[model samples]
Target chain A: MSKEKIRELKKKIEALVIAIPRELEAYEFYLDLAEKSADDAPSKEMFMFLAKQELFHRDHLEKMMNDLQSQLEEELKKGK
Target chain B: MLPLKKLIVHTHHIATHFTNALFPVSAALITLYLITDKPSFETACYYSMIFGLMSIPVAYGSGFYDWRTRFQGRRTFIFDHKVVFGIIFLILASIVVIWRSYDGGIMYSVGLNKWLYVTLVYSLTGIATWLGYLGGKFI
Candidate 1:
């Protein structure tokens, strides 16, 4: 790829990296709301469940970054 | 990001939540219909389909948004009940839709006994709870 195109992709990737922590924060906030009330069994269960899912998302994102870094490294080595 | 871009992305995210909201709302309505033996059971089925259908795009889009925009380089799966649970419930909702809407209409019987419908609701509601759990973990 050309230098300009590479620059743009790099910019995009950097922006995405910034979003990871923010997304995790948002998920936590939402989870709190979900868990605040427990009028019924279902209500109690669902909110807790949603909170769990958000945590899961955080884990997934971290793993994805690690994998992508390795991939980027491999490509860099090949070019060298 | 520019304000316009952020607004667009936010709208997309909210739409996903709205779509998922359909499943529970419809499930509760279906329960009401079944208990009173109201003819409204058919209406409930229709509503369930609509709600379940909404989840497809919402789940897909919100999920896509997170994957593409937010969680691109993180270890997002270690605590990933959200991915696993969400996918399972979405699949179940789709199956229920097909089961109910077969033969092109509710009136057109697919020859399944009445008990099956009851079973479907129970199963779907149970799955919904599981989904809620996974979703909760995320928060």
Candidate 2:
């Protein structure tokens, strides 16, 4: 790929890396909400479910970040 | 006339809670599959969808009964909103599951853009969350 294409891919990877923390924050928020709602069975169950979903989102984003990083490394190697 | 005491403690309560709970699981599984491109995650997503679909009828049946008996035929705006969104959520979720199944039970592997499938599942999750929020008003 050309230098321009490589630069764009790097930028996109950087954005994805930055998003990882935000997903973690969401996970924490949902988990905390789930804990607080423990007295209310239905509400607690709902929040717990959301928390699990957020955890999955965080894990998935982490995997995506790793994949993008690998792709970025490949592009950089080609550019070099 | 349905007894007020029974309406307060309907068996459907468990079904509705289980149904609402499964929505998040479905959303999470799909999100995991989208990011990791894992076949296992995709399979889990399919299973979650199937479970969610199974729970819907029980949840809806009980919820409808409660609405009719407890609310006394008065359709409040909030209740109507919940009903409408609930139906929409069901349709959207069904489409996602059916599409994924017909596409060979793999989302990213399908010919269609992966992001589009991810977006569809995300929207379904958002709709389910909204429905839960509306339902919370009753509590």
Candidate 3:
């Protein structure tokens, strides 16, 4: 409701936004690993599995961002 | 005389090394992309996966053939572990690929939760690495 609280929420949103890309990078990296190990059947499979998992993390972060955005909007409305 | 068996073996050797060489580079690219947020690095990561995926069946096929022909009916611990891990990896890889296909190849899109995803990835990587270690011992 207060200016200070709104600023803090905005900062948290920024942090979450920054984190989303990092998660994407991780997902790509694991996929890359999986691709490389593909020749080594078992290793490749494992990496591919890991890559998928990373993708899921990135998606989760994105959902969190969406939730935070809605909350921020609600807070701003309350302040108004 | 370059027999078919020897030729297949040689092919497998090359395929294995080629695949192995790609791993660290892929890992590095991923790390770089994460830290720098560079699209160029991400491109490299995609390239690595493409090449690696192409090579998987070759390696797996050759390895499976060798196992069946050479180690048939001998359930050694190492051999068994390799087979089981290999299958697990395949299943996981399939799921990953299918998910990616549906998600339009964007990792940061909607689907599962963070904790579960992290746990699964870390666990899979650990297991894969262990499988590689066991493979090295046998090789």
Candidate 4:
């Protein structure tokens, strides 16, 4: 629980905080494309696929944030 | 100030799309390379797999995040299926990348390994489609 270690953990959590919504937005953007391309089967399928990937990315980021939070808590508890 | 998860999720829409797009593209490229026996298509397929393999962690990470926050880390059937298949997808993609990298002539060789290599590459698309379908269920 050194200061630098704590700082590094904080930085990662901060980055994940910034990333979560962007991932969600990407999910929505691809979903919109899928909807718009309904007439073209291939295009629609590709767009829908892309949208799912974005959702997956958002979920991944949230997991990272949770991990960081847990690590920080452990560090803080050790320090005290 | 907006909370991190509350901010617009539209930002940084780059690498994951490339990651998501490239697997299927690689599958298609390999299909053509098999049919035409074109070196260029095979090379393209190799590069696509490399890039696609690189971006998987990002997609995997973000998907885990969504599951935790949206679903409260609940162990539902779809999420469980996604987790299992997603890991398989990751492992399979890694195998193909390593297999091809170690032996660049894999596809050209005439053997079970070559067909397995090709079959694994094609399965990346199948897994991606399945993963996508699971993600759709979440929506």
> All candidates' lDDT scores?
0.59, 0.71, 0.62, 0.79
lDDT of 2 by residue, B40-123 (tens): 887887777778878888778777876666453444456678789888878877887787778764465555556677777778
Tens digits of per-residue lDDT, candidate 4, A1-80, equal: 58898888877775565567567768878888889998999999999899899888888888888898899889999999
Candidate 2 Cα errors over 4 Å, as ranges: A1-80, B1-9, B110-113
For DockQ, the strongest prediction is: 1
TM-score of 1: 0.51
lDDT of 3 at A47: 81
Worst 10 contiguous positions by lDDT, candidate 3 chain B: B113-122
Candidates ranked by lDDT, best first?
4, 2, 3, 1
Which of candidates 1 and 2 is the stronger one according to TM-score?
Answer: 2
Interface RMSD of the candidates, in order: 7.2, 20.8, 23.1, 11.2
Clashing pairs in model 3?
A35-B52, A38-B56
Estimate the TM-score for candidate 2.
0.56
Task: Supply the DockQ value of model 4.
Answer: 0.03
Residue-level lDDT of model 3, residues B7-114, one tens digit each, is: 676676677655555544555665676589676775675566456556768877887775564343334456668788877765654554354345433534344542
lDDT of 1 by residue, B1-139 (tens): 5454345456655654554566666667667765775757657666656666775665566555655554442433322555666677677677667767663344334556455665665676666566555444433
